[model samples]
Target: MPFTIDNTILLFSLLLFIGVFTTKFSARFGLPSLVFFIAVGMVLSKFIYYDNAALTQLFGIMALIVILFEGGLQTKWRNVREVMVPSLSLATLGVVLTTLVIGVSAKFILDVSWLEGMLFGAIVGSTDAAAVFAVLGNKNIKQRLTSTLEVESGTNDPMAVFLTVSFIQLIQSPNANIFTLILSFFWQMGLGLALGLLLGKIAVWCINKINLDSSGLYPVLAMAFAIFTYSSTSLLKGSGLLAVYMMALWVGNSDLTFRHSIFRFNEGFAWMMQILMFILLGLLVFPAELVQITWQGIALSVLLMFVARPIGVFISTMLMKFTAKEKALISWAGLRGAVPIVLATYPLLAGMENGHLFFNVVFFVVLSSALIQGATISPLAHALGLSQGKKSVVPHTLELVSMGKTNHEIVEVHVDEHSGADGKELRQLKMPQDSLVNAIIREQKMITPRGNTRLQAGDTLYVLARKGQNEEIKALFHQQVTEQDSANV
Candidate 1:
């Protein structure tokens, strides 16, 4: 069952089926699906002889883009706004601290050169998007806490990437000056930010202004532009990863036509990419090499879990208002995934002397993180009294979009069981100024809203509002919501 042309399609389909099917069982057992995905890859690895650093790196980049784009689409800008400073610090300073601690300690523990140790540190510094998504999907938590973690995991990859590449360059060119490296970092990030924002606005403009016969073409156009953002930014020595994410953030928060469809499509696609990347990385491994790095792997894993991760979380989030419990949960939630394995391939592709060792050590660290941290996140969140109960919602109406150009948005807002809109008259809801309630669909019938119309649960409001008042409208209905309220599930 090696990954080759013989029965290729059959093996591919089988892997996908098995991988997806295991998720249900994994969820039932409080096990993260990422761990299962890697396990599937590792099991298939026993039968395959696949190893190519360059090819793995290429596919890994594509997977990351798709994953990050999906993450951006779902991330609400409002949720991230209050947590921005802390998230930014976590993404940048947290990554640096983790790298330094792990790198410095690796020199003593793994007996590697300072450069090699830092390279290892840089590869595994940030929490993984896929890993976080999987574990957190099972738990119900406060929105602010969830938002902080999600934003950090989604955005930190770029900083981790910058450090890895910079350290690699330093290894290759020993005379690389500190000033040059610092300048390069700022240049890459600044240019990436400018380009991503510009492209996102341009993408929205094209989507709204351009009219194609088929609605499908709009999504195609958006996808093409997103790919262009990453590729073009990379060509200019900018952070393509950061650009893709920022582009996704802007487009996702915008009120675009057929956005619901696009969100669903990208989510499914991200999962597909995750499955392929994890299994492929798994299939690409040689068990003999993993065996050889056992003691070194254990030592490195302990240091990362105990020392590097806690320091990164506490110091980075010090200025923020996170409680001691929240910081503890954050530290314990930093699970690594396929990203580090993919990054480890960089050394191999660059012809570094310890590339093999780097890959093996990274594989061990990822395995340990997924098993240890992944297994404990839910229980730990509960112990810290941070886990909120999950609530299930049924979609009552489609987010309908009309044809032709329009600046106004028609949103279907759900009235929670105890939300202010639950019993208050329509006028008392205190919605944003200039907002209009087009119709209220109760029990499968439409009622034209009036000042005294009493709202209730299971009532779907067809409210018309200005394009930028989404958060405001949502606030009007969430009056009774507590701080422990989970996201709009």
Candidate 2:
């Protein structure tokens, strides 16, 4: 059978369908969706040959841009603000520390040259945003711990990219000064940070002011600027990944036109990017080649999980307010995914002596991390007494798409079994003057909220209220603490 453009489209569509469908099993089996996505690619690898490292590398970059931007957009600023200092510390210094430990340890364990070992360490140094976000999606851990890990994963890529590129240069030129490279790192980071913030503020202003003919154009405009931010920063010798992430963070947190619509669109787009990236990486692997690196990969994975990551977390978070348990969970949650495999392609693209070896080893390590650490995060959290249990699933969802700047937003308030407002009629409750119940969701059915309607336990209220009324609204609906509850606390 001759493979034509039609055939390519058909295959691509089928892969995407399977990838999306794989999430059901992920939820049912308590594994990360990425694990299933990659597995599907590997299972089909024999039939579909994909050995283009350069093309894979390009796709990886595009995917990461969308993923990071969407992640930043969805994250709340208040959550990130409290842990910014520690998160940045872990994202920068912690990455460096992890790389150093793994590099030094690999020199002896893998019996490789100093440069090669360091190169390997740099490849897998940063925790993957896709993996972290996917695993931690609904796992109700402590807010501080979650924020720290999320911010760290979202921000650490630039350091890994820098270290990987610098080491590749050192390997090619052997006489390059380490001091000069270290200085270049600072220059790149500083410029990236400045450009990201500048462009982000400008982007937000433009978004708020521009009135396009079609509302759909808003998201399109945002997407174009996001890519431009990365390219423009990179062309000027800055950290493109960091610029993209910071830019999205600023834009996402700002009050802009159709903010909810833009967020929803970007989120779906990010999922497609994730599926494409993992499947492509999965197809790149050959089972025959991976067998050769099994022992080496396992050894390095153990070292990274147990030694390198812990040391990095402890050292980076020292003097901070995190407990030992919090730090331990953070260390264990550093699961590598597409980013490390993407970095592995660097040596291959550069045509290094051990290019193939580098790619295979890194691929094995990533698979191991995703399979082991990724699968066990929830159980480990529970055992450490840090798990808050899974979040209650709401059958219905509500979103407020703003047409223009407004102070009103939709908030979901859940009624507990014996909450303050559980048995009260909607008219009897003391709601803020500006607040209105949009709808009541109970037992997976939507109810038109009337003044005489009584609020039942387990009902989810979608209330449209002005921004400042949340505290009063929550207080009215929140379950009051009784003597028994106080005793339990």
Candidate 3:
């Protein structure tokens, strides 16, 4: 049936209502809301049919672009750098290893042809950042592990997609040369990276240069720009997913105006995309096909979870100086998600033989990974001794506003030992220029500083630093600590 305005509005309204309530319901039941979203989609599919596959596919792709961009925007460069080497290795080499392992195992054990087996492997190889981000957000996990998983998921899709598409091409055209395949892969990834960075920089310039009256609308404009970047890159034969993610990350980490509102908007939008994507995928599957694929799918999933994933993790982290426990956790945390199911649709759309089985198998794999890895993350962290009790809270940014002839600025800083103000007289430690020691809270007691007032360890001191001197003052304090640590050593 042709899509009518009423149908569009009604479907969207139902989706939004399901998205909101399922989140709360999932939380209450200790279940992943993605499961509920998929279930909802399945239920809707029975009653309301969309006869147009192209429209459904377009929606899925568009949703993925939005989801990837939002994930990129949330990625912190600081966090990415901490696990850069391992994360890169995991995303690239690990994906290759996983694909090869699953491919080989499927070909030999499941008696599938080489190309078909590899296709199956390639489809399931990439981890879903949307799933990982949704599950791990606001959860207390070790920074390094969390960062590694998040970074890997965020960056791995390009490589996985390249492999999947490359294999698909090879399967369709068996006469294609190896050199051609290699060149195409490099071209796609390189162009995608370049385009993403270029577009992101351009968008940043535009956002900062264009002074808009309504700050609230800036985020919406920014989101539109992000989508445009992805679409343009993909049209140019580049990886749209890669470009969108990189651009989002750049915008997110930059000093954009209305940063808080932008993040909030993206966060909600991302969740909505995820819910819609999972539901659409679930609706695409038939329960009978899912059952037929179950036995072999379960076998492949075991090989993926227990064999392929661990080997991939080992190869990626072997050179790194991680503890045994850390390695174990990393190996176990390779969670499959919506990406596999999405990729499975490709083969089915192409009318490949046994494509229904492929989709069903991919669905089962995603479910198993989410159920096992998602549930055990916290326990695994605790077992590895990587769970830092509660995250130490720190305020890193402060807002400043001004009125005629007076200015008010909020200051934020961390309480670290060896700070000049630590275990010493606040007066004795020379204050930076144009700064006032405003408030000090030590062990829940707010005390006003006097000339003889001594600062203690664990005291959070809020200083009213002068406008435009905040950076200099912070530098001075940090410099004092470096010198103190050197003296002690």
The sequence of per-residue lDDT tens digits that candidate 3 reaches over residues 1-489 is 557999888888889888888889776665567777878877777776633445556777777788877777777788878898998899889999999999998787667799888888888888888777877675667788888998888778888878877777788789989898788777888888899888998888887677676666777888888889888988888888888888887887775655556767777887888887888876776666667767887888899988998889998889997888887888777777877877777777777785767777888888878777777776788887888765544433343322112343445555656575577787777667677777777788888867788877677767776555555666767788888888888
**lDDT accuracy of residue 391 in candidate 2:** 67
Candidate 3's C-alpha lDDT?
Answer: 0.77
Report every candidate's CA lDDT. 0.82, 0.86, 0.77
Query: Between prediction 1 and prediction 2, which has the larger TM-score?
Result: 2
* Model 2, span 6-125: residue lDDT tens: 998998899899989998888888888888888887887888888999999999999999998888887778899999999999998899999999999878877889988999999999
- Clashing residue pairs found in predicted model 3: none
Sort the predicted structures by TM-score, highest score first: 2, 1, 3
For model 2, the run of ten residues with the poorest summed lDDT: 393-402
Q: Kindly give the number of clashing pairs for every candidate.
A: 0, 0, 0
| Residue 278 C-alpha lDDT in model 3 | 80
Tens-digit lDDT track of model 1 for 285-395 = 777788888998898899899999999999999888999999988888888986788889989989999888889889989988888888888888888899876643422
Candidate achieving higher TM-score, 1 or 3: 1
